[model samples]
Target: MNIKNRLTKLEQIIRPQQTPLVMIKFEDDWSPEQQQQIDAAEAQGRMILKVVFVGGKQDDNA
Candidate 1:
């Protein structure tokens, strides 16, 4: 399913005060801007994110 549809379904299922932890698989490494956005969100305590890349670029501590 597409991200928007999945998110809509999730919104319907989750209750107030509940935050869902979502894991998305990407075809390639994310861009610097994307990482920056995620970092900013984390710094603000808005969300918790951990990215695990596989193969040669794998980063367990990211």
Candidate 2:
């Protein structure tokens, strides 16, 4: 299946009212083009993207 179809299926399983923590990992050396694509996907509002960078240490509050 295509990405849009897969995303739609995921959205059906996860309603808007419900908030879930989502993490997307990318290589530290990701190219600018790759970053732009990620930004564009976020702009589409198809899903929620939370960008958090942690180096070894974890956030206890979470």
Candidate 3:
């Protein structure tokens, strides 16, 4: 699915009190331009963006 569709699906599964974090895993190197885009999107408003990095396992007991 596309990014928008994936995001919508995530929203449907997530609850009001639950906060879902988006982790952008990059295998290769990342450029400053790409980082700027992510930053701009996150600076919009609360619940507008929830990005985080996950190394291995994730907890879903929140």
Candidate 4:
């Protein structure tokens, strides 16, 4: 299933104590609906976001 579908499915299950967290990595921006879903998940503190730049150079500043 796609990310949206997976998130939607996850939404179907309400588990705050034993909730599943999802880490999403994407190079491009998601649609409004997708963002809403992500925001909702984040409000529940069950999602992590990672932005990947395809072919873009990364600097080690740490």
Candidate 5:
């Protein structure tokens, strides 16, 4: 509500937290070895982010 309170709240919101390792994967099938790597990352508290193919239906499988 006040200036001080607003700044405090903003600071709290933007405060740095525990940064998790992000694993970005493209839109495709993963081999057995790759899947194991993903599983290992999850076990170590890493975050896995997947991306989907948005070009076309036919191209998605290609």
Candidate 6:
């Protein structure tokens, strides 16, 4: 109701979150091994974040 109370609530609710922007560049020199590594990382991320694949489906084999 008061400014001080609102500021306190905001401070409690507005904690910083670390968001990772994971990416892989598929170049002409890319290999299956690199893809495998990316897949493993993405699989781990799926457990931590509710990742959704809009362009293509996630590798079930990962």
In candidate 2, the residue pairs with backbone N, CA or C atoms under 3 Å apart (3 or more residues apart, or in different chains) clash, namely: none
TM-score: model 1 vs. ground truth: 0.33
What is candidate 6's TM-score against the reference?
Answer: 0.29
lDDT of 2 at 26: 65
Q: Candidate 1 at residue 59, lDDT?
A: 89
Sort order, lDDT high to low: 5, 4, 2, 1, 6, 3
Tell me the spans in candidate 6 whose CA falls farther than 4 Å from its real position. Answer: 1-26, 46-62
| Predictions in order: lDDT | 0.63, 0.64, 0.56, 0.65, 0.68, 0.58
Instruction: List, residue by residue over 13-61, the lDDT tens digit for candidate 2.
Output: 8965434335455656546865676676667654556565658978899
> Which one wins by TM-score: 4 or 5?
5
Q: Show model 3 residue runs off by greater than 4 Å.
A: 1-27, 45-62
lDDT of 3 at 15: 39
lDDT of candidate 5 over 1-62, digit per residue (tens):
89999988888789744455444456367667768877887887666665545555576556
Candidate 4: clashing pairs of residues = none
lDDT of 6 at 12: 64
Candidates 1 and 5 compared: the better one by lDDT is 5
> How much is 22 displaced in model 1, in angstroms?
9.5
Best by TM-score: 5
TM-score of each: 0.33, 0.30, 0.28, 0.37, 0.39, 0.29
Better of 4 and 6 by TM-score: 4
Which stretches of candidate 2 lie above 4 Å from their native place? 1-27, 48-62
Tens digits of lDDT, candidate 1, 1-62:
99999988887688334353333436576567666766766675555555666779678899
Cα lDDT tens digits for candidate 4, 1-62: 88999887787786435355444546367767667777888887774554555676688895
Candidate 5 clash figure, as a count:
0
* TM-score, structure 2 vs. true: 0.30
